[model samples]
Target chain A: MNDSRYVSTAQVAEVLGVGVTTVKRWVDEGILPAHRTAGGHRKLLLADVLRLARQSNFPNQNLGPLFAAGHALVPAHVQDLEQALFVALERGDGDLVRSLIQGAYRRGVPVDDLADGVIAPAMQRIGHDWETGKIDVFHEHRGSQLCVAALHELIGLVSSSAAGRRPLALGGAPEKDPYVLTSLLAELVLRQDGWQVVNLGPNTPLASLRKAVNELKPRLLWLTVSYLEDADTFLTEYRQLYQESDRLGVPVAVGGRALTDSLRARMPYTTYGDGMAHLSAFARTLSPGKRRPPRGRPTKQSNG
Target chain B: MNDSRYVSTAQVAEVLGVGVTTVKRWVDEGILPAHRTAGGHRKLLLADVLRLARQSNFPNQNLGPLFAAGHALVPAHVQDLEQALFVALERGDGDLVRSLIQGAYRRGVPVDDLADGVIAPAMQRIGHDWETGKIDVFHEHRGSQLCVAALHELIGLVSSSAAGRRPLALGGAPEKDPYVLTSLLAELVLRQDGWQVVNLGPNTPLASLRKAVNELKPRLLWLTVSYLEDADTFLTEYRQLYQESDRLGVPVAVGGRALTDSLRARMPYTTYGDGMAHLSAFARTLSPGKRRPPRGRPTKQSNG
Candidate 1:
């Protein structure tokens, strides 16, 4: 392992919101493990520091600098992180939300879990709050916008690690569906599964998607329908899109809140995903070749 | 002025893609200006280095790292940047597109100019190429995806500087209109002009927007109609939306390719922005309190 993946004593102190002397004391007390550089500067593995921070019950807010540091992969507890994200998002703290989510991903929480387990639930609760008048529309909008911003940041991170040669998956929300978050989350989940995705984003027409199928010939085409203005029209247009994709031998994956059992019953697709985890599992079956992690994949350790 | 805004000689060399010795030589030869720290380490003004980069005809590609540096502001030639962006988008170089656009915004190019003068034109050409069969659909999709990604990055950057107390502008593309770029560009322009925008994004039904207006009571609303599947329905729904906004005392800004002269004559809007520049100017009129840049706005120098 590269020693450079380890951070200096000063960085640990800064990340944990403590003094360097305290960090040194922790190292000396065997509370944390450390190695010494040639100049005798104590270098601690980023993972160890994170573990100690977790055990010592350090506030997740203090881990903001750690997340922004973009250091080594250290697996994080998913339940603790989900709760942290809920609090951060509720407080309208966009920076904290970003740090928590990005930090978890960097530390080896899979993107699908981040989507299905963390962000989706957090946003669902926020949406519920908005519906019940627990939060004002502006507050809800702000929270959603912050989530979109965080997801885009995650997309950039995932894209940087992705090999562009992977099988193409082109997708977006169908017509009259203006939900940006679900589609973005879907893109992130598929991207993490090693598919090169061309996310058309929200409100893509079925006709345009058919043209995309004819031209781009993506290996997979996904539709995330969060809202449907005219279900009859959607069904009709979707039938045509399905025919086009079938003709091109491309499998269609459909999901989202609006894709109720009745709606999905009429809309035929190769797979119906209830959530990002389902989509991720389906994507793996499509391209088992990419089941292996990309080269230079970060080493991760579970609590077990 | 904060001298901290100035970067060190080594930073200048790294940004310029040159050696430190060469940068030192340039300073000594009076080709570039520098100030000395107490330890005699040379600290060059970032603007001067950027100006030198432009004048010396350094390849715009080499400016990638400079753009990523995110340091001092220095005015850049917009035409040169437009050309650079066009090439980068055509080549599917998303990172370069991001760096060029973000760099210009950091260096004092208004978001509207970046939207109108740089990104819009570049994207128009790419769209034109796709129509003429000069490029494959995958290439066009890739380019558009890259633009979306870059714009989102700009949104995050602008939002960080936004006060969040500004007038809210809630809007998106109306139903059957599935364009993402124009709406996102509008959000960026409005945000730069001090609007806390809640961009509902593409394919939003006018009825739902009416609900948002009722609840949010935004100061302004914007609709970018890039593609309209049914003009008469849009006209009817938009009329209802206009009446609602009028009752709520919210100004409506409308623009996009689908709004032809005849269509526009039938559609009522507080203002019809032909492009982002017009939107920026109109936003300024609504909130002159924000005509001045935010506090700690970077001091920028122009080559003129």
Candidate 2:
């Protein structure tokens, strides 16, 4: 493994005959096994990028080596769109807000980029303003509602494009969590990858998750922890949830800001991701059909 | 005795300073009484149409008698767009499908009209084609997904425009009912009337509804009856649901095609609607603050 064997995302896109954004999405999703430079620019390993270019002809691109060495198509960013959206949110222009979002999605902006890059920072600003008395609670609430609605619309819009029975995915915020957005983000990201995903919504009890597990029988269950008052207390509450999930034989994946190092160590059975992108990447590796045993049948491990 | 009380929907629309589609929607929703002639042309009762015009000025439109007397606007029937959507769905053009729906909606075509006139009929055609072997199950399922996704996107789009503290409204299809779409339609309609709505999704158990009512403390609960295998059995199942809703002090409203006159007569606590438009009109009349007492306390009626 050569430490210096790294290529810029643009070079990867050129080698793949796709947009830089697409290449970045693959790298960001951990699909191409890329690393970041000291200045925080994405740098894909040359061998990994070349291997990916070879493996995923994508059936549509039909590119040869010459095309693989194609020139970079276009640059990607929403420097101005983000500002326009902030103003639109403040003014509460629902139509423009949606159009802007839809346009971005159409332009190939990945859901994770929309969530972490744009909305997250914008939402942080809005929250900070509300905290410092720069804006009223009503204004903040209205802003929040606009963002949530946009996400819901975007999710619904992309979800329609799924042509067949995609992977089954279910997720929601854990009990006492006010953070529903992350779950929606996860749903959108998963759905974009052609997963038939459902969000259980915020403040979901563990029993409710267990019930959903039994009913929907989803292949993957995502528990989002947006906040934790006490790491000890949170771990204590979710430990039983993990045991129940294991008993039910469902894969449990966890993520969010509150998962401290100690808490994560204690719940080592769970898979973790930093955000929607990571979760989506992990989901790509799961197969619902192969993972679960026939209903009420003995596990293959047990049979063995 | 006035047989000439009936007028074309266009005439009614012209007199109301609204589009022809609005009149047709009003008639279709049972908001204003109307009947179809032998040629299947919608003819509204002049008296009923006038009464509705008097009642619904709708904040933005400043139409007195003069606006009603204005020239006839564009033609109504979503027929052409529906045909286009059929092709789009057949070809799996997601963007075109969404564009068609959004364009219709932007042209002042109400949600109820879209659901009843376009999607319902198009879906029927798709189902028929599937049954006749004109298309495969994959085609039918794909078409259904497109329609459902459009609805979800539409709901999110409209729900964002609501301002202020909206009355909390909750709804879903009961267990074993494959009627998720109706619940979503109800959500869109209610949200338009400044109601904070939550759709619990299809195949919801009564126990789940009960649990949601207790937790969310919604002012009005909508239980959509999309299908009933046995009227008597269905009535029995939801009668207990009505009692649970009553116990929780939340009013239950039921709708959908499966409802029969005989079955409906037994459930006196429920309000019924033809589709989304009527349900929206009904939701407008609810007052959450005045209707229920503070949570965990006895009802004012009981305390008194």
Candidate 3:
């Protein structure tokens, strides 16, 4: 296998001589470990892709450059700060949450890292607590609100929001999934990477996502599924969306806790790993240095 | 009917010589039509209530002073401004939407009225367009984001957001319903009535709702159902919530388009009418003089 850290599910399917449906079933069934993009695309790790190929009775092959590695970008201080952020959220301290977020950004912790490492995990913890009955509903809801407010504040602070043609990305949660925090966090991360983003917010239907893809012709699309009770329906829509947006060169990224391993393999799109860092890395690779042109210019995105 | 415009489902059930469940069955089974409150409580028009009773073979005995009336509260100018708001939303003119809202508030169109009449209708129309194919997914999503942004701006503009000791109201969409717009609008409405609100946002579970009621001892609790694919599941939770919170004096107000006539009857809670005007009026009647002393004071709510 040639050098590349990430391979599309399609690439793996071809190598295995299996249909995309079978590949997706593998991912969904946890046969292959994969990551999802913010746009709901699935990206397979090189090792996992090769593993799937071998498991399907293919000859063992040496994967050289294909197995690229991603180094950690978030520092220890940033990790510590994430804990502080969580405390503030649990306390329902909007001001404290804001302060910690602002301080992190000031300290040079990338905004997206803050989202992926701090905000996302903190919310997950809170959610877990709610599920386990450690905290009451009021506390959980309060934590959710504080996180939203913090992100809203972070999004506001982005200096180089977007002017015109700076590698635009658009996405949101699928319909029936009201989780907007993930999509909003992705928006912040993309903005920090200097990509102008349009977040479709929570409970977004496929019709709307398709409309956005057509109208915006975004360079990258983000789809996150935080809630997934109706897997069959969601899978059908995901597959349909992947097929519909095929003509466009724009890459679709799908991720979130909802993407089971087996499900990821079945998805025909790129999968993003956990956190804003992976997404940021993906953005860098897709359109390297796209954010360089208009550094620190506060302006609106002109219609392309 | 003693000069009351509304009656609880319990009263209706008593008059019909049936259990509350049976009365709810009438509503749920399409034998009756009723409305819901923000707190998930059901309230029927006195006329409707009486009609239900009569249809259940209720004695022709008069409801007497038990029946009352609720007058319309939305003004003509507010209605006209609603049309203007729709135009702005269609144009995706964020600035114009903001300016129109600020102007409306300045001209004495209460913030809640703007929510109920202007913003809600405009959003509904946009949603309708999307449903009918007058617009595509992009337009609908864009329209939704615009409405959210507009409300955020309006919420920001409300001076003296909350003062101490005001009637506290808490609410959000039920679990799996990611629609937070309604919850936010309800926040503005409650705040205008001198109620300090904690909007739990969308997809809030009943356990959390119960927790909120216990902690806040709020005067009112609001629950909205914006999207409901799992009717049986939603109804089960709604009914359970009503039962669980029965001990608390805090009235659970349930309202929204998703509250079908039968669904509202089955759910034992106060039902609110369409628009913020009705909600604001409900707030006033729920806690009269709550806003009188702090009238126009842009201060944080003092604890009662």
Candidate 4:
């Protein structure tokens, strides 16, 4: 017991009742905080040991200060913008979104960069919290409104160009799911990749969409659906649309949480999984060239 | 057809053969890049639409370049360092671990922060690629080694005073389901929460862990098992361990992908679904005296 000066990873495992390799992995992942002595031996603090004992039974306590202290121990600028954005959304503060975006832009963060780094992550956290029941429906709705309004304003800030960029069709499933944020993030990512987007705001009728396709002759349609409940109905409608659209040479791309399900087999189109990372990939597939490096690529970088 | 100068969101949706609601959601999510005309009508670029159409069938193909583009879009100062670290890991450059740590530290970024923000994400990407056969086992091993070494060195830089801060024990299940990354991430999170961590690494023998618990009497034992294949065995062993550990007055905390499965019943122990967020909550649980704002309380600052 007196050997508390320096605890071997094995001893630490014994204390925690875990395997030695797990301890090493924790060390490797920077999970278990440790330090080496002048002689290069690892040591663990006593207090942390006690905290671990309590953590198993009780999580969701306030350890912010402890984390803050630990963060202070490590050197780096902690990005708290996402949390702030979440709060702002809950409050439905379009003004706050504007200010945040302006601030990020002033800091040399691009519009798309703001969308990806700040807006998207913030939205995801909000969605996750809302889904987990940590935040109520009203709070989630308020946040969504603020974000959508801010995004609209951001669209206004970016100038309309006549660069002959290809047009994209964007929309999502019914309001019951209410996850338009995924589509918004996708739009931002596509715009960043130099694609021109035509965002049809949520809840458009299928007949109207078919008519638009017949009239406008858009080359691609991008759809976002987050709920699995409407999968069977949506697929039935999608099959009809797909069969019709194929004749017109217009392709449809589907994405969001719903697409992750195995039911995708019933749908004829492509499914993009969670995150803008996948959305951007879907957008890229629409472009006719082989995979090209972003910087050296020939496309003009639009502020949109 | 001649109205190509401006396309209504409705028209765009029709062109894509999807419901207007779907299109609007895309617009709202920023998935479909769009510009509003002076009258506030959304316009889509023909080229962008065409590109989306071409890529609709192959979503996975977009991953590589999108990831590359994302890395490129990060702030320049961090970009080179991040890329170098990833490349080193990709190449299995063992010395690069120390060099990257030193470089980041010199630039005022803590090694832990770098690992969390950059290294971990990169590793996830590499792991995904490895799983999908996009990257070979060699690359995966190389990246894992570099990360392991880098994290170990980073832990070495902390002061012994920090080592005395708190004690935590970290471990996971056997090697056939080797997912030490989760444990590693958990350890970092706990450490950041001011707990001193003893990482047991991976594929640890259960008996040895029990023996360690007897010897060290550490406060907490963290177990991570990421795969589904070992869930039944793990659960059986976990029940036994729970009974045994209960006798010792130590709690077992469980986490990783497997914990979320519906088939698995909620055990008596705590389960963390999200990684860092869960760890943060776990830390708070350990320290009851800390002040936590109500879930709905508005905070002024943002956390990214």
Second chain only: TM-score per model? 0.76, 0.64, 0.67, 0.57
Error of 1 at A72 (Å): 23
lDDT of 2 by residue, A39-147 (tens): 3456444434433433333322222322222222222476566666676666555556666675666444666777766676666667677689775543444456567
Q: Native contacts retained by model 3, as a fraction? A: 0.40
Model 3 - which docking category?
A: incorrect
Give a tens-digit lDDT track for model 3, residues B1-304: 2223566676565444445886676677666677777787777666776554444332221231122122122123666667777777777654456556654664346677778778888888988987898987667676677677556545544524234466777788887776677888888777667676677888788766877778767788888778887888888877767776677777777788888898777678765666667777787888866545445743332122
Model 1, span B251-271: residue lDDT tens:
999999899999999988999
**Scoring each candidate complex against the real one, what DockQ results?**
0.17, 0.04, 0.15, 0.01
lDDT of each: 0.73, 0.61, 0.65, 0.52
Q: Residue B191 in model 4: shift from native, Å?
A: 48
**What are the clashing pairs of model 2?**
B14-B68, B15-B68, B17-B68
TM match of model 1 to true structure:
0.62
- Scanning candidate 4 chain A in windows of ten residues, the lowest lDDT window is A58-67
Which of candidates 3 and 4 is the stronger one according to TM-score? 3
Which model, 1 or 4, shows the larger lDDT? 1
lDDT at residue A26 of model 4 (Cα atoms):
69
Q: Candidates 3 and 4: which is better by DockQ?
A: 3
Cα RMSD (Å) per model?
9.9, 21.3, 23.7, 27.1
TM-score of chain A of each: 0.71, 0.65, 0.68, 0.59
Would you list the rank order by lDDT, best first? 1, 3, 2, 4
Interface RMSD of 4: 28.2
TM, every model = 0.62, 0.43, 0.63, 0.34
